[model samples]
Target: MKILHLFNELKFSGAEIMYVSAAPLFQKLGCKLTVANTSLQLGEYTPAFKTAGYTIIHQYIPHALLRQWKMRKELIQLIKEGGYDVVHIHRSDLRWIMSYCAWRTRCKAVYTTHSVFRSHWYSYPLHFMQRWTAYHLFHCTFQTISDSVDANERNYYHTQTTLIYNWYGSTRFYPATKEEKKQTRLELNIPQDALVIISVGGCSHIKRHHDVIKAMPTILKKYPKAIYLHLGEGNTLEEEKVLAKSLNLNQNVRFYGNQKDVRNFLIASDIYVMPSKFEGISLTTIEAMACNIPAILYNVPGLRDFNKEKECALLIPESTEVLAKSIIELYENPKQQSTLIQNGKEFVDAYFNMEKNARKIFELYTKR
Candidate 1:
């Protein structure tokens, strides 16, 4: 089968990573997979897609209505000429273009709504008009990454028929050996006795990287030798760095902006934490778990869905003192920490094995 996947940006987000990881699996199954990004921004994940040896097409569509129509024609022409059997969409923007093109070409359409989507007050009228009227595309298979996001989407957007969990590529995200960890840590100039914590997400208010930086002082009160590593880059990177400096955590916090081998940093770290205000089964959480790191996350919607609370992670509230104590507690309690690590590994192996989950997606593509 020939499949064409669409996205607004090819950035290092959950949806993009899932598409990049699954494309190879689909190809291995004797299917042709091509990626199309409509965003004007050439995203960071584009190189990763090229490295994986898949064709990537850029349409460069923004919010202009006339431009959208032109892009819709471009999508239809591409799908027809490529003889694509399925057009899978992972991004929300320009989705109407994807849907209309697929409908025109008679290609099976699939859309997976990642939870990063939220309606703005200014765009309510336009959104309401689309949702209430028959103008919105509905003749397609719909999916979401988590139950909570699925519920919210179904109530507001469209009905989702499947719940596909986010899966991490096993080749990149896996447990490191003793020697491998030692070498990675040594290269980073990190001391063996220091407590290393990793939090990866693009710098943004929603991701709450600043919250983690603020929580660092309290964490340092107990574990003074703690090192908090921040990964990912975005518009808010300067704000987070400024906040960290203001809180006197400049020494304790190391901000690495968008590393290609993020899994290496995950393997080098002792624990993974993400206090984001939102997510749809965050791909980082899955990758951290797959790398055998005990994850500590807030009890937000997406995290709550994945939490066995004490089993997979130390799922806590958005409190600095509580987060600090949880880190110290997880460190001191070897038995509990080991249990969390084992359980995380089990969870990743069972639910997030890339090959297994990608096969499920391939099956979805072959339907109808």
Candidate 2:
């Protein structure tokens, strides 16, 4: 079957990474996968998509209403001509555009809501219009990667969505050997005895990287040799670095930009923390857990869902003081750390095998 996955711009983010890991399985299912970049410029992960055996194409739609209409016509025409059976949209921004185009071409439309987000009150009209177009006109199938996203969409748009949990690459991310961990730390110049805390994702305001940095001062007071490894990069990266420098945390913090192999870093770390304001379901957090690293996440919507099934990670309120205390407490208590690690590993093993979850998605494509 021909499937076109639509994205605003491919980045080293959860959806992109997940799809890359699942590409081989999809191809094995006799699926021809194509990725369409709808943004003005093709993004950084374009090469990765190419490597994953995706047919890459640009279907740029301008921001202007008239130009968007024109481009919509072109996209619809292309979809009909190409005879794509499914247009699976991973980018929320392109939901209306892709849904309209796919529906016009009589192709099945599937959109994955990657986060629990809705616009401001002023934009409610626009949101409702898009919802009407997608649900009523296009008959698009909506998929939510987490319970939070499903609940949020139901509450806001009144749309019942299929809840498909995001899966991690189990073979790629697993517990590291003691010797491998030591070698990895040695390579990264991290002290073997130091308290290593890592958060892996793009630097953004919603990620609340600054909140973690704010907590570092208190954590340093107790564990003087504590280290923070900031992985991934974004617009707020420089700001996070500035905050780290201002707090005199240059010695304690290492800001590493987008990484190709997060497994190595995950292996080298002692703990994982994601203070994200929200998430559909954090891929990094699951990966860290699969690697047998304990996690401390904020008690926000997406992160809180992790606590629902079982206490996979230590969930604390969105406070710098609580964060610092939790980190130190988790550090000092090895037994609790082990419990969290074991629970996390069990959780991921039970629900997050990519092969199993990816087949569910492939089945969605085969649906009438």
TM-score (all chains, Cα) for each model: 0.90, 0.96
Clashing pairs in 2: none
lDDT of 1 by residue, 1-368 (tens): 88888877788877777777777677889888788777887787898888776788886767765677766776678889999998888766545566677889888888777783668889866655543331345456766777777877777655545777678888888899989999999999888888999998778878888777877888888888899999989889999888888888889999899887888899889889988887878889888988888888988878876664336887899877777788878878888778888888887777777887777777788876
RMSDs, each prediction?
Answer: 2.6, 1.4
Q: By TM-score, how accurate is candidate 1?
A: 0.90
- Candidate 2 lDDT tens digits, 1-368: 99999888788999999998899999999999899888888889999999999999887766555576668878888798778999998877678888988888889999999998978999878877887779778988888888889999998888768888899988889998999999999999999999999999988999989988999999999889999999988889998999999999999999889899898998988889999989989999989999999999999988888777888999998999999999999988999998999899999888778988899898888887
Q: Please provide the root mean square deviation of candidate 1 (C-alpha atoms, Å).
A: 2.6
Residue ranges of candidate 2 with Cα displaced over 4 Å: 63-67
Ten-residue region with minimum lDDT total, candidate 2? 61-70
- Top-lDDT candidate index: 2
Instruction: Give Cα distance to truth, residue 140, candidate 2, Å.
Output: 1.0
